[model samples]
Target: MIAVFDRVLIANRGEIAVRIIRTLDRLGVESVAVFSDADADAPHVRAATTAVRIGPADARRSYLDGAAVIGAALAAGAQAVHPGYGFLSENAAFARACAEAGLVFVGPPAPAIETMGDKIRARAAVEARGVATVPGIARPGLSDADLVEGAAEVGYPVLVKPSAGGGGKGMHRVDRADDLPAALAQARREAAAAFGDDALFVERFVAEPRHIEVQVLADAHGAVIHLGERECSLQRRHQKIVEEAPSPLLDPAQRAAIGRAACETARAVGYAGVGTVEFIVSARRPDEPFFMEMNTRLQVEHAVTELVTGIDLVEQQLRVAAGEPLALTQDGIRLAGHAIEARVYAEDPSNGFLPTGGRLLDVRWPADVRVDAGVAAGSLVGAHYDPMIAKVVAHGATRADALASLQQALSATRLPGVTTNIRFLGRLLDLPAVVAGDLDTGLVDREVPALSADPVPDADFAACAVHEVPSGHGAWRADGWRLAGARGAVLRYADGDGEAVVTVRERDVVVERAGSRAVVPRAELADLEVRAAEDGATLWVSGAAGDRAISRPALVRRALRASSPELVSPMPGSVVAVHVADGDEVALGDAVASVEAMKMEHVLRAPVAGVVRLLAVVGAAVVRGQRLAVVEPPTDERRP
Candidate 1:
C-alpha cells in the first residue's frame, strides 16, 4: 500500500504548480499554495485548497526562500512539500530542510540532488557508468597553459559552460583559439551572476546537434524505467520552444538505445522520482546520441511524455516519495500516440523575443487542445516571472495528425493586450522541415525569417473589408442587394506595411494597382475566405499601407502604424552599455547602444547616418518603443 500524506504544500507558482495541485486533488489530498505579492491571485493559488502569502515579489524572499516555504508548510499542517519545476526543485538544501522538519520532500533525496546537481561531479559519475559523453576537461584554478592544451586536444569550436549552471546561461561557444580567453571570462561572469559559480569547463561543441532528452522514473525500491524520448531541437538562445515525444528523426532501435542509456545513467546515480537525461544527438548521424546532462527534477517538457504515455508524472512522484515501487516495468511501458507541445510566451518574436509585460486584456485557448496556463484573461503578465504564459499540447494517432492539430489550435488561439509568438508558432508548425521531421538545434535559426513572415494573404484583406462594410437599408438585404441610387459608407484600410491604403465601398473594395485603381467586387470576398488565403484578416483599408495586424478579442481588428522616430528604443530591456553621445555623428547601421533583454545582448543600430540629437543617459530604464536616442539626417548642404 502506498503511504498517503494528509496535506501537501506546493512551493511554487505558475502552470507546473497548478499541475501538481490537480494531481494532489485527484489523490484526495489537501493542497496548500504559497504565493508572492505579485501572484496573490494567480491560478495556482486559486486552485489549491489552502493558500498562504509568503513575502514580497522578489523570488529570493518568496519562492526561493526555503525557510519561508517550509514555514508555510508547517503553518498549514502540510505533511509534504512539492517544489514544482524551477524555483527550488533541484535545491539540495531545500530538500534537506524539508527532511529536518520531518516533512516528506516529493523528490529525490538530498544526497542525490547534491551529487547530480554539480555538473562536474555528475559528468564524472556518468562517465564511471560507461556512458559515452563528450570529451572535455574540468578542473579548478587551471592555468592558461592547461586551457590551451585542453582545447588543442578537444579541438577548436568548444563550448565553455559553468560547472553549476542550468538553462542556457553561463554558456559560450568559442569558434577561434584567440577568442577562448574572452569567451571564458564572459561565461564565468555570467555563471557567477546567474548560478553563484565561477568555475568553467570546456566540451566539444557538437555542430548542428539535435537536443533530445529521455525521461526516467525511479522509485525508492530501486526500480527505474524510461519513458521514451522528447525531440526539443527547435530553440532560440538555448531555450526550447517546441517539443515532441518520440523524436521524428529516431528509429525504433535508436530510441531503445537512448532509453537504455538513460535508465543506466539513473541507476548509476541511484536516482529517485521523475528525472530527465538530456542528450546531444549529432545531426550528422541520427544513430549516435551523446549524454549532455541530467536534470534531477521534473522537466518543463514532461507534459508531452504524459500525453503520449498516459502517465501522471506528479502522481508517480508522490508514489515514489512514499517509498512505493515503480508500478510498471520497462517492458510494460509503451509509447502510444504522438504528442506535441508549444510554449506560448508573452514576448515579441519579431523584436528579438524580448520579454513583454502588460495587462492581459483577453486570453483564449482552443477547446479541443490541452492548455496548461498560469494566467487568465485580465491577469497581468509581469516581469517578476518567466515569460511563458501557457503551453499548448496536442495528441493524435500519428505525427502528421498531431502537427496538423497543433497548427489549427495555434491559429485559433488568441491573446490580446500582450504581444505573443502565436503567429510565429503557427508558421513553425507549417514549416516543411518540421512537418517532414527533419530538425536540429539550428533549424529555427535557419528558418526563423520564413516562419515569422506575415501569413495573411493580400486578397483576404480586400475580402474582409468588402464583407465588413454595411449594406444599404433597402431591398435584398439577405443577398448583396443595395438600395436604389444609394452609395454606401466609404471605409479605408491600410496595407501589410501600413505604407499604402485600400478603400472599400458598399459594392467593391479598391486596392492599389500600379498607380491605378484595382477594384474587387463584394461577391469575390466570400470566395476568398473559402480558399483560406493567408493575410486575409490583416488587410488594411485602401489608402493606408504598412499597418500591422492588431487582432483584439472576438475578431476586433485594428491597424497600428509603426512607432514614430521619437519612439525608437531597444524593444524592452535594461541599458547595459551606451555608445552614442548627444550630437555625435553616426552612420547608417552604426552601433548606437546596447541593451540586455531576455538573457541576450541586442545592439540597437542607427537606421540612417545622422547627427545624434537626444540620447538617454546610461542605466536609464526603457519600455517597448520608448525613445533612447534621436538621429537627424544631414541636410543636402552638409553632405560631402
Candidate 2:
C-alpha cells in the first residue's frame, strides 16, 4: 500500500472544490487548487493553501486537460489529486495519467472507471452479477430493423441513451415506433458532442420513476458499504433540482434490498473509493428498482448523504485512497435526520430557465442552514461554466422540518441583479404534493406555471418602500427630520405588482387603498439608515428578507421608466444568425437571430410586429433583454 499523501491537488472548481479543500484541511493535508482565468477570483481558489493557474476559462483547455492538471499537481508539490466531480472526474485517461505521475488518484482505479463509465458495459457487468437492470439493448451495429426488433423485445416507450454518457446528455425518449429513427439520430449527435461517443443503446423508460441513488464506499481491502439512499425525484429536463436523504418512499425492507443489490454490484466491479449506484424506482411497482448507471466518482448530491449519516464523503475518499480499511461496518451506520438540498442556479425560471450572466450585486443566505457557495457578491456569473451559483442544504430531525427549513432559507435568501431559482424553490417547498412526499420527475413541468408565478406579496413591496425611507427622517423621531423640521422627503415607490403607488408622507409610507400601516420603529429605523444626497435618499434596509440598499428617488424614476419601450433578447448566447432588415415588415415572434449558448440552440423571437430594426447581427454576443431588435409598430399606427 502506498503511503498517505501530505498534499492533494483539486482539479476542479465551484462548491465541490471548496468542499474538498475543507476536508483536506481537516485531515491535516495541504490543498492545491487549479483554476482557469474565469475562476481566478472564485471562492474555492481563495480557500486553497496553494493555487495554480491552469489556463483559460474554456473547460476544454483547463478542467478537461488531464495533462495540464497533472502538471499543475506536480508543480504545486501535491502527491495526490482529487477530481471533484464533473469535467475529468470520470475520465479514465485522467485517472491513468494521475497514476502514471505517481500521484494517488483519490478515486477508483482507471480500469474500474472505464468499466462503469460505459453504459452498455456497466449494464452487462451488473447483469452478469444477477442484478436487475432496465430492459434495454447493449449491442452495437443495430439497423433500423434491429432497433425495431430490440424495441419489441424491450417493450415500447424505450429510451435511447448514449452508451458512454451521463448527466442526461444524449438521451431521448421514443413513445412510438415512428419516432425511433429521429430519436436515435438526435441521441447519437448529442452523445458525440458531449462524450465523443456516438454509440447508442435502448432501454424501457420507467414511467414516473423516482430517481433514487445509493452511495457506496469501498476501500482497498475489497470491502464495499452502501450508505442508504437519496430521493432525487424533483427534476427538470432530466437534471436533478432538489435532492433529499432517507427516501420517504422506501420502507426499511425495500431500502435494505436495494442497498444490498448496490453493494453486490460494487463488489462485482471490485470498486473502491466513493461511488454512487443510481436507480430508477418505478411508481407503479415500488418492489422493483432498476439499475440505471453508476457514477464512478463523487456525486453532486453527496451532501445529502453527508447530512444524514454524519460522514464527510470526501474525507472517506481520501482515507480509502490512502489504503485504509472501511472504518465502520454496515451495522454501525445509522441515518439520523432528514436532509434536503436545493441547487440555486443563475437562471430565469420564468424564461425557459435560460442561464443568466451578470455581476452579482448582492447575495445573502440564511444563517441557520448550510450554504455551500463558490461565488461572492461581486463575482461574475459568466457563460464560461455551469450556471449554478450555490447549493443550499438544510438538515432536520424530520422531513417536514427539513422542508420548512429549506423554504425559510430560500425565502431569506436575497439576490439582486441576477435572476435565480430562489423564488421557484420557495414555491416548490410549499407545494402540497411535495410536502406530502408525493413527488415525481414531472413535478416541475406539471406545476411550472404555478411554481414560476411571482410570490412577492403586496405587503412586501409596501414594506420595501417604508424600509427604503431614510432613518432620521422617518416617524421614529418626535419631529422626524434629516435636516431640522424638514418634512419627510416625498418618496414615491411601486408595489409588488407595480400597479399600486406608494407615497411616504411625514415618515409614514402610505399604500394606496391599503389600510394597514407598518411603523418604522426607532431601533429598526436605525437599521434602515440612509444618506441623503441631492438626487436621492440611499437607505439600507435589514430584515428577515436580508439587507438591501434602496435609493428613494431612483426607485420612483425606475418605476416610471418601467413603462418605456424595450426590446428583450431571448436566450443567453451569441447571435449566430440574423435575418432582419431595417424597415422590413415582420409579425409577432418573428425569428431575428439564432442565439447559441450553453451548447443549446435557441431562436430569438420578435415580441411584436412592425418595421424590424436589428441592433445586433450574426456573431454578436447578447445578454437577456439587451435590446437586440426594435419594432416600430405599423406606419399607420400612432405612438401612444
Q: lDDT for every model?
A: 0.76, 0.77
- What tens-digit string does per-residue lDDT give for candidate 2 at 375-482? 887787787677777899999999999998988888777665466777788778789989999887778778988887653333443455554553425343213433
Which residues of candidate 1, in runs, are more than 4 Å off? Answer: 141-149, 178-182, 455-504, 508-622, 626-640
- Candidate 2 TM-score over all chains jointly: 0.81
Query: Could you give candidate 1's per-residue lDDT for residues 1-640 as a string of tens digits?
Result: 2357879999889998888888888888999999999898988989999999999976779988999999999999998999988889989999998999989999998877887777778888888988888888876665546776798789988888787767777777778999888677667666765566777788898987899999999998888899999999988767799999989888899999999889888988889999999999887877788888888888888999999999999999999988788888999888998999999987767656777776665566787878888988768787667788789999999999899888888876766556678778877877888899888887887887776665344455565444454352232322354433344433344333432234555667666532555666767655342211133433221111111243211131123223223325545566655667777888777777766554555667776677877567666666766777776776663778
Candidate number achieving the greatest TM-score relative to the actual structure: 1
Clashing pairs in 2: none
Which 10-residue window of candidate 1 scores lowest in summed lDDT?
A: 539-548
Candidate 2 — what's its lDDT?
0.77
Residue 367 lDDT in candidate 1? 74
Under the 3 Å rule for N, CA and C atoms, how many clashes does model 2 have?
A: 0
In Å, residue 333's CA in model 1 sits off its true spot by: 0.8
